[model samples]
Target chain A: MKLRFRDSMNWLHTWSCVVLGCLLFAVFLTGTLAYFQYEITHWMQPEVEQIQHKDKAINQAQAYLNTHTENAPRWTIVPPNERFSPIVAYWRDKNTTGRFSVARLDEQGNEINSRATRGGEFLYRFHFDLHYMPVFYARWLVGIAAMLMLVGIITGIVVHKKIFKDFFTLQFNKGAKSWLNSHTVCSVLALPFHIMITYTGIVTLMLMYFSWAMNMGDGDRRSFFSAFSDQAPALKASGEKAQLLPLGDIYNSAKAQLGHAGIGSIIVSNPGDSNAMVEVYENATEELTSDYRTLRYHGVTGELLHDSGVTNAAEQTRRTMISLHAGRFADTSLRWLYFLSGIMGTAMVGTGLLLWSNKRKQKMNPRFRIGYKIMDVTNLASIIGLPLAISGYFAANRLLPLQLESRAEWEIHCFFIVWLMAFVYPILRGCKHSWQELSFITGVSYLALPVISIFTTSRHILNYQFERDATLLFMDLLLFFTGGLFIYIAYIVWRKGYEPAVIARPKRPPRGVVQ
Target chain B: MTIKAFLQAISNAKGMQILWRVVLASVLGFIFLSVFIAGVASLGSALFHLSKATLMLWLMLIGIVLYCCLVMWIFASNKLMRCSVIIIAGIVISSAALYAGDMLHKNHQPVESR
Candidate 1:
């Protein structure tokens, strides 16, 4: 029963990956999609495609906020960036103590009646928060899975002694070997990225995951956060009313101070109060480190109050690590690399799942083993089903009535429903039949997205020339590209047949060892 | 081997041993590793006069890699007993160091009322 160190590692890597692979796959897929979330959100909300001027949009937002949110305690203006087409604005009234109320504005600062959809924010949130569950539970579950993934990655490296030698060893149509090669290549090629991502992912929620560590310090979590970001405590709003300085002037001053650094957002706190503070936050995307350079000004007098930048080396290191993990600082090309790397991570998990089932299938009499059947169904559902569900989400976005109540909720419901169906279908119809059928369905659904968009909204690939919005055109092309990949995969699955043509079963070990 | 056989194996003594080893490697090993990192970080903070938050973050960043190494060692060890001994020893040593660091920190600070 005694295993060599390498053999034990092999065992660990296999079991850990199999146990957490499906969730890991979902996480990786959604996280990858989140990289382009803003772009996808823009594509989804086609009504705002006409607003092109970013500076003019901010002015419009100011005018709109002045009239609408005069009595509000706080107002934030998120100027349109490369990904988001709309001038997004939010205000929190003194009466409502909860989250701010959001409004989408156009070039003229008038509210746009956009279609009700969660857009890319859903995918972005779902990446970590997940669906049909409380965020607290979801994050914990995801954190555990990420930790296991880190374990798997390390053990996998140990198990594969010939990692470098096998780096270029890819044999197509070799069945299990092919899958193993793919898994290996994906993991090895992006090994540094995989490590960075897994470690940083854990770090992103470190406060929650290791709350005990924070408790070891000063008990107040707020103080820890304030110390972490190096921000001073905000002064309370004075009751006396005052005439606020023009936002345009404050923006100009902030722009001058930052000197070419893009302003990510403008926060006006305690609006209409004498002690109102207007803070402009610099876009972190311009540099590798996620610098939170802020210039706080007196909201009324336009006088500069405080400017804080990262000064401490330790804090800078921490922020840099976080920024690297988020990839917010990455330009378009670097973002694509991050996306591709994320896709590789996802594929590695997928192949690992398949490898587990494939290795077992080769040795066992497939029909007799209920375990094999379960594995088969799970692999099919998670690997192909989630994508199918995502396609369903997009389709629902297009098909749903514009004025339908809870339209965003319905889109999410449709996603889960389709995903649930995928999970159940394999169990009922048999894994082989379900895999082929669902794969085709997924392929068709994705391919049909462009046509659906053309019918549902004015924003289509055809209308890209009129709007001069490359983001819209690029999104359409990407969808088609993904659809093509799925269709090709479906075609391969159909052509190759359901069951493996040859089963190269490994010999059973002695009674002491399970493998 | 069939599914029945595999299930039977899992219920048997040898399977239980393997299961315990996995637990040791993943769970106890992680705890031991975190404790060790905390102790080291506390000491580092005191020595360098770094803020507790900064040192904690630095330790956490390093802990990821350190934990992986510990896991590898846990699995690679020739005996489960050896792995257990290592983790227990780590916990004991780190706890003492952490306590010492806390005492030193308290002693260095001037008494202040809330």
Candidate 2:
């Protein structure tokens, strides 16, 4: 039978989301939290105090490395920025474990024993590179999820009627209609953000999904990546040894040459060799594009060798798209905006999934099939499970032994284990009562995290000064607000009566349309 | 149910049609997209004088939109046979053009080893 485009779109949107909505919700929520990744890391590793002078920190870092790993051929320093997290240093040496060493340094450039946790970096990577899975499969899964989101947004727009009027209309406690209204309001409020985010997110790693595109390419892959680095075939280690110049001097010269204060990272190839080359990478946080403006310098002589920055319009567009998706260039205020829009995206997907299940249940009235039970359980775990898992991750950070072997990996294990329990609990209790209990448990766990940290760490919530320890304070307050919000949800579910006591089935559509 | 009855169930058409759409949209859709990228890159090289680096810069970035557009079109239209035929034909033609281009490159750079 022939159907209107919008009718087909409605069907497409429903089935597509029904299949991929859980993945979309997890990605949206985790990715939204990743906006404050740096701040979260700072909170997680409070031992690394804020630096007064970044240049001095760089110089002191170089000095520490010079004295400590004198024989190491290579060194790379990821300098701390406005976030005030500990700087990371990597060096290559034959005697080291895994042929390399990585150390966290405080503001004074001394090695510090920060609690071992992947912190927000894990959450950020988890958004795209899921856990307990190979990177290849994880990326493909995320890529499909992004594609689903993009299609869902498009089809939703097509099927929506009276869009402007619907945005202003939200009828509370009206069963499926309420669900529909919440979903519509959330989608309409952040419509542009949803489109831009999904499109740009897919572009960031589309090739992974379309791996066959690699077969169609004719040129060396390095050429495509050459835009990031302009160094003419890195200077190999020479037999003859020479004294290397102070890295502080090179940093100064590079700053003078580039006239930019935002130095992101510094890489030194073949240290103490005559052919030593130092590459200073520009942070370029002030720019629209996330292009890596590299300045290669002669390590011994401190002479400028190469600088690669300019690109064609197409390349510029590509860089800008990626930068926009990552939002690394955004200041704190704009980052919060991205974060809030992401929350709305998560809410929109949640309500849409609920509406789908609610509508399906209404249609099959009084005959609750096992299929419908499984559907309810799936929704319960996906919507409530993930936040429960996230809270578990934070709790593990404070509760786990500081010196536990591979402490970081175990924190993640705790997260997944709790997530598994989230599913099991709902199934055991049944969906009807599970929503309130699970959310309440999740709420209590989140609230308990800041309290846990108070005794575990040197600092507490109120002890942290706003100006000096803003990240620490923000993290505590965020946990409190999130906990309170979840508790409020539990109350709402309890009051409204979970599992919608009665929902009127939508009427049959006109002839020639499949509704 | 017997095999005949099961076959009849499928031939009732709704279930089988969706399964066909899934296959067309995923496996064949990927092949179509790959061919589409190769075809676009080949045509761009022949026309624009852009380096492979610059060409790929645009190809991979914009290829996402093209892929989404193809998926939407595949699902929106009910004509499955036409979609499959167009996809297979596009692949064959694009492969032939790429093969021809490789031969031409070999002729020009006979002394340069692959």
Candidate 3:
């Protein structure tokens, strides 16, 4: 069959995206949520949700560590920030069974009886790690899918000649065309961002696959990394017996050096070593990449020996790419842009997947029919069900008994369990009903989260409003709005009747096309 | 050249249309497979052995190449492009397999010293 180039590409786009659409859906959904990972963690941990006096928080944590494990060589503390609830310190203890030990710190910087909770990290891991597959395979699978996604994006642009012209055009009333139009607009609006993100996300960890480059270079990989480190002098521990200095001094020094730069993390290394050192890296607040300021002080003597800020051009470029992919360097407004672009990317994949299933449903074969049905089921779970599960996770954190030994774990488990039920529910109930019911369920679940938090916590929505905890308030409002979106979707489902009920099978294409 | 001639020139250049697609697909497929294999082999090993950055670079390179191939494919014959893609992807798969074998062999090799 002689196919037009655009028609050929259209075929390519449909099959390529459909092959990995469900996987891409999960990735897009979770990855978008990961933009607000720290905020979600903050929401989950209501206790340290809005921490003030960060200097005190670090001091308290350091004070607790001083009493508990002074002999440990390296100490790293992520002081409770506004984005998370717990003030925990992760350390390397030689005497412990494992090299790493995490402890929650009290207000006075003392160790509190709290377990290390993997809140957003679980979702973070699940996005790339995937289920039933080894993390490496999962990453590779995601990489291939992302590559396909890039292809889809490019072909989609080529096929839609009016992509830019129709940028502001979204005809909601027109069925398939409207969906495609909206998808195209979103996908094209941030096409460059999407392409770069997908590409850099793969590149940031390139050496893992291409070891030939390593063989081509010097034998020592550290030396190779040192090259990429932009020839910044390798940091060495100061060799002098001295007492550990207060973290507050280092914090102040970092701020003074890199005025207004975002503080990434603080590390006081080799504390008990004769030549201990303190290294602090401050992230760039504006750029998409990292240009960090580093100050290495003699650990015990409190003497500043060497200070370096990320000044190299290559390093800055790399940092910028990283920042763009992670969206870590962006302020709230930029983050919202990232979020909007991500939603469009998600819609692009979702509509493409729906179109695939829709087209396939016209076939009468039992095997193909069952396959389409299965695709529909998975689509529901990946699209609406996963978000609903995440909303349930936050709700459970507050609603579950805090005094229970494994409260945090239980909350995370509830999320997966609900997702599993969502997977099963669609298979049993059929696709159309599942779509409408799940949309309604997801809508109600999300809306109920803020209400649940308000009822359970002393700091409700009104309380947050008065206290000016904008992060928490924004989180609640975001949930409410998300709920409203889902409700609107549910209404659409009801108004149109179920999709299966309304979809009339298309007659065979003119003889030349199919068979 | 007329517009049709320009299009035909683009289509006829040495491996111009289909070759790039094949090359791109092969590179990307190789990167994906190799990284996956390397990560699995390096598990429970020293932290120094893990090189995620390298894996990422290769994947991104594949992405770039794939996009380029896709552009060419849009202009080239579907039959020719698909065949080329298959051939290139096959080569990449074989290379990855060979590399994995080499890695395993080296990993098992005893340290020889004076």
Candidate 4:
């Protein structure tokens, strides 16, 4: 009975992983990349150089807003941080609808005429809000996949009873065993991270998945959010205009109140009116919880209005889970740890998918069956083709004309078009040939990124100015490393072929009869 | 086991039954577990005087692990009929408890003038 139960769990783990493995791979890869999203964005927009004086960023942002958006009712200033250098500011007029108009400023408060691109934000958003579909549908699909993944992980642990014993058992060149070993090693190495990331990812979208629970309560969604966050109510704007106090004074007061915590954003509501308020949000990097301690002041009188008190235990616990998932509080070293673990998670999925095909391939007839063929094509596209598409996205950023209209949208379109082409290529050509070719293409594209940057932009790795910008240099080196890894794999596939030599093993009596 | 023997084993009638059992466990079984969890959590929220949001958050946080355990349980059970019966009974009982709790809370509320 125990043996039968173990077999059942093994079956559950394999099928669940194979079914949703592609989407999980995409999510894991993009999420891993999102750890460095801001750095990648900075690297993409080369016109905005990193500057030294970050303390005066608020004053510079205020000055820019005062000059350009004098009549605007609301202003938001995002100061320069370690990952991003540009002081990004945005404003909305009293009657405007939709998003606020944004401006990027250098240290001296000069507006940069940077090329229009979504930059790393496309990759970041694509991790959850997948492209070419409505966000609502994408999230639901991702949520289902995430739930299946949780099931797969739990069942996988149960099936592998000798999990600790086989922790370091990664045999190579042994066909199905090799693939299984790789899968096990990757999954086991980052098991804790996998569990935490998957569970917290679901929690991050808890409201959507469990909205029925919220509806059962007395309050609506907004009221629930306000209760969860303990946010102060917003004061309505008065028509009577008043001379606004200097933002520097408000910033100073906020800094004094915050003490050791850093300021993240400065928000000014009703900027020129009597009821105008300035809200300063603290960066909760040193703490586990993402509850940003806020201080609000009357813009006209410069008198402090509200100070966000300590969060209760329940809210603090919830926020901490969110923070753990987002890793916003992580420093550079810790962020890299998160990134490496995420990569392991992606590799675990990739290996699991490959194992399914390999296991079935050994048992199936020499001629391709429909099931085996479908698995082959999907495995090739998802494991190899998706990375190729991401490389194409970076290439498009450099290749596309700078003055092109809707350039950001074009970049995203280029990504999907490349991905679709990859998805189709294996169906036309055989899986082995297509995998080899797509991998080669991916390698060459990534390798050529730095060269293309050298020709097109002043922020290339070879340029003298890039010597001072560690972020750009690090990104180039990482790209080069990835390019080399892909090329090596391509070469190996070409030389040794896709499938390993099937080893002969002695047959044993079939396990306990099926229930 | 040899490839041919293994393939034949899976293609047999008994193997087909196990396959369907797994399919049931993954789909219908998962949904039933989720509904059962929601009902129980709602009942707990009403009984304990906990804020619905906080209790719901705790439930959602642990819901995935519980669902996985349910799937494992469905597969591990010796008799499929017995497992299904228990799951159905759980759903019915929890739903009734939740409905009763809702009604009691409504009756206790002060009626407002329209």
Candidate 5:
């Protein structure tokens, strides 16, 4: 066989991807789901669905702050939006160090339930935080994996020269060829998305690893930040003694100046101080830039202090990248597109790993065979096993004893314990047996999630159906479909019978050796 | 080229390709498998042992040794004294580093606890 540098790189690309593919798949899957975290949270908590009138929610938040935190150090209030019901207020007391209190608000600015959580936000955080690892380290590890992925993408493009020409190709009938074709189709179709996601993921954490670049370009970090962001200097006030001011005036002033855009949030600094600032951020619906703009006011005097224009081009570009990754600005159709692209990204990595394992098993010795088995176990554990575990977490939430000590921790522990078992089970039983067994287990577990939810929670699908709580129904149906996909994969594995792949290794001799 | 030389060339080529794929698979497979084990063990140990630093030190040490072994298989030509010496040295160095980190972390645990 003639060796080309291009071929070697292609080989490099294939192996690098196969090596890091499972991690990449997990990242993409979780990240995509995280895009609709608000919606998912809304769906999960049926009671909070579209309850608070927008005006009322804001007023309630204001009243609550006036009563409970009139002299608090700082107050941040996130008003209710079309998608969410609970008006949120977060504050820190001057005496307490690094502690913040969270509460819901009514239109009169009174506190509602303080305990109702930021639902999908937890999942969104989980995508980056990951389970069982320190957040910073998890991100660093993810970043390295993503960089390897970027290498794989570039090399893959070079190797598959005809990829562009056969961009739309999808062959469903020819077994392994069909799988390869679908893989190529999914990968090539959303090639740009894959590239953007990988690049942006790295860029998001650029400052952490590459702050020296900023320090080189600009002398100090503050100057570097100020060069891109025109954040106004905060107002200063003297005297510990201060008086409460009406929030309504500042809120109205910001709305009038920003035009048409309602205030999504307001942050009051030194709330009762003479130079207190009230920064009003606009709502999501009015302008595309509403999400980005801020109007600063004198909280004490209700005087308009300063207003930053919606966003500079650079800021807009950054926001757009974040929005694309977040899927926050997208409607239902576009959300689906983001999801499909993410699925494709996951499939691309998954197939790459499968191809790697398939190509390797032919010549591997028994000792090395154990390594392959470990890989297979993890592949099943993370890719097929995690979603199953998350479902278990939710089920545990509904089913576990609420009065139990450290209930939340126990719920999370169940998830990890089950996942750990899944990871090790493949090692104990060997790859083939574990693969078949766990895929079936995952399928059955996911299938039971909604049933368990209905049994445990007061609200049933039928009740939700009557209430026209479409979001809840949608989630339950998605769980069912996920179960079906698992079963389908399990059946395929069963029918095929798990053993070494049938493809023979290429036959050739060295350049100078005798036969 | 002679027929014998050509035939020998073909067989050697086949062997090299098979060896390359096998080595690549084992390396990639081992890398992933190790990371996953390390990751899971870190979390489990954190709750159980009240610290995960020890588990991480062990993982990093094992990883370096495994990596050195893989490189020797892929690149080192001599199947004689060199391979044994290199592997032995790698194991010793990795073990030493791991032990140092573990001891240091243990000694400093009280400070961190406070």
Candidate 6:
């Protein structure tokens, strides 16, 4: 038996996708949404209004920090940005663990207690960290999935003979042929985005994948990272007490130096020590590159010390790739492109999964093989179930008692619990009914999100507060459109019905059988 | 070739051969990538004036690209035994290059300093 390269690629592409398609779907969906994570966070925490003044917020945050922990070893101040997060101040006391305590400030320069939801942060971490698993193992698993996706994408390109020409062809209702067309169209629509996202996603975790890269260095990771990355070298306190010069002075000097670029964050190391150093990082919005400009100053005197940034072309290329993946520099319009491309990637994976089952159903005798059942269930659960589970997460954020223990963790719990229900529903009710029912339920649930907000919070869609800010209105419109799409899909699935695409072929005599 | 022609050739693969290829590409391909990175770094030290960090990073980027291609080649090649031999030969040759390159760099460094 002999196989050519293209034939082998087809087999590799199919099986690789079959094995890892569900995981890839989840990652692509979540990661794509994370492009709007800041917007999502704004929606989840509706009470926090936009800041009218950036510099004033910084001064207020510093004053508040002075009142709270005067002699704290370190303090970080992040000014309010277009992302809608308030002025945030982070600090760590000597007695506390290494974790910094976060405080949110409103326009009035006073600390405000918003509802206790992880907000967009949970989605951001979930894309890579995952849940119900340790971060170490989860990262490894996600990394492996990313690598296989790269394989699938490359092999997929090789296997499709009319890959480019198929961009013009579509047969809407031909069952298996339609599924193939759907997969091909989605794949072709955003081929570059899929390839770039997969490759850059892997680069984000490449250090972990190639941990042996550490040995090539001269055993000094701190200096190596500082040299190649944007971090300043680590500093320790002198233990001699000294007052920090007003942050406003340092901000003014850095502002003059930075010109048009706004300061994104200010970190002061050893605030009360003689050797205190203040680090100011330039905002990411000024450039598409993730390697932002940095200015370090003497904490007491407010003199500019040094600027830390990418040293050479190699590091710059690496940093740019990561920045492209994160999309942190994306403005409103570019973010929409990212979101739409993400939707395309998710649809590609979804249709690929469905296409697998459809192809098998056509070839095999229609019976209850565990493999078929599992495939059909996964296809239904993942494509339809994920949106429903995400809605459950949002619902939990609104409904859970604010004072409940570990309320944030409970929100994530709601997400997984709903997801598990989605997985189980198909097995009990059978895939045919389950697909339509779950999609319909998911659609209504999403449509009901705005209604739920009306009852649970002060800033629902019907309320007058939306007139003050359009973020919630934007979110509500998005939810309604998504709900409408899901409903349309359910209708289509109901009309077409889930009958097996059984192609009746005449059987040939058994080859080389001894009669 | 058409899709039909390409798919007909898929019937040529055996179950055992598929399993062997998976292991050889994933596990052994990674080993080759690691050694290849070290080999490039060592060889780069004598040739380029770049810092170790920059050298390692660029070599890693190159190594991963090569590894992705190698994995594809491992499956596509009809000669499965030959693919294994090539991977093994890669490991051995890269390891030797690393050793010899390191020695050359060490010998070359002092004279330049003087």
Q: What TM-score, computed on C-alpha atoms, does each candidate reach?
A: 0.90, 0.91, 0.79, 0.87, 0.73, 0.90
TM-score of chain B of each: 0.77, 0.75, 0.33, 0.73, 0.37, 0.75
Model 1 C-alpha lDDT per residue in residues A279-316, reported as the tens digit of each score: 99987777876456888898888888888887766667
Candidate whose DockQ is highest: 2
| Candidate 3 lDDT score relative to the true structure | 0.68
Interface RMSD of each: 2.7, 2.5, 9.3, 3.7, 15.4, 2.6
TM-score, candidate 4, is 0.87
lDDT of 4 by residue, A346-377 (tens): 99999999888777766776445666778788
Better of 2 and 4 by lDDT: 2
Residue A217: error of model 5 in Å? 3.0
Per residue, candidate 5 scores C-alpha lDDT tens digits across A1-515 of: 34565765666677667766777877777787776666666655555546445555565666777678645868898766655556778997777767598776555555544223445665676666776778889887776677667767767787777787766555675656665676688779889988877766665664553343233222355654554455689887665546646665566567678776656678988876777888887654533344467788877777777777534454455455554555555667777888888888888877777656655665665556557666777777877777777676666666776466666567678777877787878777767687777888888887887888776666657577644677777888887898888888889889877774343445579888898
- How accurate locally is residue B93 in candidate 2, as Cα lDDT from 0 to 100? 82
lDDT minimum window of 10 residues, candidate 2 chain B: B101-110
User: Which residue runs does candidate 3 get wrong by more than 4 Å?
Assistant: A1-4, A80-87, A97-99, A111-117, A130-134, A165-170, A209-220, A230-241, A309-312, A363-367, A501-515, B1-114
lDDT of 3 by residue, A1-515 (tens): 25688886776677567878988988887888788887776666555535567777777777777777845777877655444545667787766666477787756675554433566777777766776568778887887787677777667777777888887666776766766676776677778877887766656545543454343222345654664443334345555555677787777776787776677777877775556777777665556555576777776667777767666454455566667788777778888888887877787778777766666665545535556667778888888888888877877777777677777678778888888989999888877688889999999998998888877777668677545567778888999999999999988888888657234455678877966
lDDT measured at residue A337 in model 5 versus the true structure, 0 to 100: 88
Docking class of 1: acceptable
Docking class of 4: acceptable
Candidate 1: tens digits of C-alpha lDDT, residues B23-83: 8876787677667656766666676777766777677777777777777676667666666
Ranking by TM-score: 2, 6, 1, 4, 3, 5
Off by over 4 Å in 2: A63-73, A94-100, A223-230, A365-368, A500-515, B1-12, B107-114
What clash pairs does model 4 have? none
Question: Against the true two-chain complex, what DockQ does each candidate achieve?
Answer: 0.34, 0.44, 0.10, 0.28, 0.02, 0.37
Give Cα distance to truth, residue A133, candidate 4, Å: 0.9
- The lDDT values for all models are 0.81, 0.80, 0.68, 0.79, 0.64, 0.81
Alpha-carbon error at A399 in model 1, in Å?
0.4
**In lDDT terms, how accurate is model 4?**
0.79
What's candidate 6's DockQ score?
Answer: 0.37
